[model samples]
Target: MPVRRFVPIAAVVLVASLAACNPSATKSESDSKPAASASAGTDRDEAGSSAAPGAPAGGNGLSLSEAIAKIPAADEVRDGYKRDSFKHWIDEDGDSCSTRNEVLLAEAGRAPEQGARCALTGGEWRSYYDEVTVTAAGKLDIDHMVPLAEAWDSGASKWDADRRMRYANDLGAERSLVAVTAKTNRSKADKDPSEWMPPAQSAKCTYLADWTATKLRWKLSADERERAALETLAEGCSGTAVKYEAAP
Candidate 1:
């Protein structure tokens, strides 16, 4: 893997607030899914310091094992899933850049030239899933680390439209949405670590950590096989630690 340069990007304000957006929502609706120890999300660095100006950051010191252990395990609900159920790629911030463009700009190894309407001309990106180097933004796909279909299966099926939309376009945590080659993104589709792992040998541990962090961040559930797979894979990732902020 090449040494990549990550440029800082602004934190997008997706909605006014999760509570304000959903007036009728109850505390249980917001808190019911999280495990006791992994109930919240915060963005803390390795040194366990503060987050950026507007970004929500905090401490989730759980090792990969503990993080995986806190994920609620339940049977998946796969029926009645529609790709459109979760709206994505919108410019919620009205910054001319959509959620996809924000990810592209943030993840680009070489920053792309931004034009009117956020047209990206040239940039370089490393598709971590396959470790493929891509210079064209058009060739990269913004992947939901936790696929929408997978989220729906886990626990999103019961969420209202607004909450589902937040999950789909989440920009709160860097791990939630990733930029990768379209090929690798398509290959991953909606399969979890249990069914698919990254082709890049070096990406496996980071991939597992990110996957676990994303699930815990949103308080999403896991099925038995998926939970077991995460636990089994986590043993090899002893050096990796997960830190995520609870999505508001």
Candidate 2:
């Protein structure tokens, strides 16, 4: 395997040839090249879309104003935080696929072969975070929009195991658990919007919306800095909207 390189963040046009809409598309070695940055000034509309009021609006839902209003602001607590506290990747549906595999299957642009024990092979995926297309299943990582550790600091530290598990394995919304290239996922490890944004500039609006919706759904608090960053990002995403149900 070759090491992947990170590109500087800049807006770039998306090649329609690699669009996620093509289920039969296969990734070539050239497809492994870094993606162009997302378009920053694009104006997408969600008018009359069936998505809930808090759900992602055209993948860029809810104006920054509306999304920020939903997040409860508070100081974070990090004392006694541990990664193992939350149980994840369970086969909640008893389909033999773990939560990780389930996300991969859901997000793949080109479907892969599923073998015994739900092993996946030969799928094509479009990683929205950095706009990278990958052919192998092993190259992707399912990322928690609001990372578990960040959640702990925000409020999950007080949650019971069951609640934490529900959050960890959430598959209810498309924005909850995202499948992205391992490089982008690792680059985002445990950071909030304040510390990181997707390398793809076009992804910023959707990323902010997803981050906000996840926090609102899980009732997670945002620290002052994180909230400020989200607010700033939202301002740039003019027509976007967000609709998320409160977490049970």
Candidate 3:
């Protein structure tokens, strides 16, 4: 068998590895490549999109003001924040389903059934990781920006499953939301922003921005190495980008 390698990491590969083992991760060569690739890409992306939020006018991406402005302040909540507290993806219409699948359908641009369950009926995904385009639902995976188990390690080990569900199904934010090829998602599984990112070189700034934003929201603190990695990511927020959010 040919040894699979990743230029960057992404959703599919990470997801599988997250579930296949655990976040402490004994990830395979197939598993590690894309997540690392994507994670690195988000750190890089000098050649970016004009409309991508991270970059500035004729430049790379956003400034610290944008990154700070967009992030919900850690002190805003009086209540404790834990991973298990957010109840997510319950069958909204009383069908046998969950919200996580609904996001998969929407992210994939698929029109789901009345229940909005994950049937993966129709959608087209051009995976930035390996540059593969897929139409089948099975080919795509809905990824959580913060992996559940990783959350457990971070602070979520204490919350109830319902709360965990909410974190799992949170689709309200662009940073926390995305759809990617199944292989990439599986490979990502449950890892920190420090551990993985997207595979598209063009998407680097946005990836880091999302990472920073997600970390801020969860009130999760990064170790020194993680913080240093994020500082490097901050460099991407240069061209064509502006302040990211309205006061939160």
Best by lDDT: 1
Output the better candidate (1/3) by lDDT.
1
- Cα lDDT tens digits, model 2, 14-112, are 122334311122323322222221121111122222334333434334455676887898999999998989899998767788889877776667789
User: Which residue segments of model 3 deviate by more than 4 Å?
Assistant: 1-89, 93-97, 109-118, 128-131, 158-160, 240-248
Pick the winner on TM-score between candidates 1 and 2.
1
**Least well predicted 10-residue stretch by lDDT in candidate 2:** 1-10
lDDT of 1 at 128: 70
Provide the lowest-lDDT 10-residue window in model 3.
1-10
Q: What value of lDDT does candidate 1 attain over all alpha carbons?
A: 0.67
Report lDDT per candidate: 0.67, 0.67, 0.45
What lDDT score goes with residue 61 in model 1? Answer: 49
Per-model TM-score, in order, reads 0.78, 0.77, 0.56
lDDT of 1 by residue, 1-248 (tens): 01111322212111112232111123232112111111112221222233323322423245678778888889999999999999999887777888899778766767899999999999888777787888998998988989999999999999999999988877665667888889988999999999998887767776786788788778899999999999998777654545555666
Could you tell me how far off, in angstroms, the CA of residue 233 lies in candidate 1 after the best superposition? 1.2
Instruction: Supply the TM-score for candidate 1.
Output: 0.78
Backbone collision tally, model 1: 7
> TM-score-based ranking, best first?
1, 2, 3
Of models 1 and 2, which has the larger lDDT? 1
Clashing pairs counted in every model: 7, 13, 69
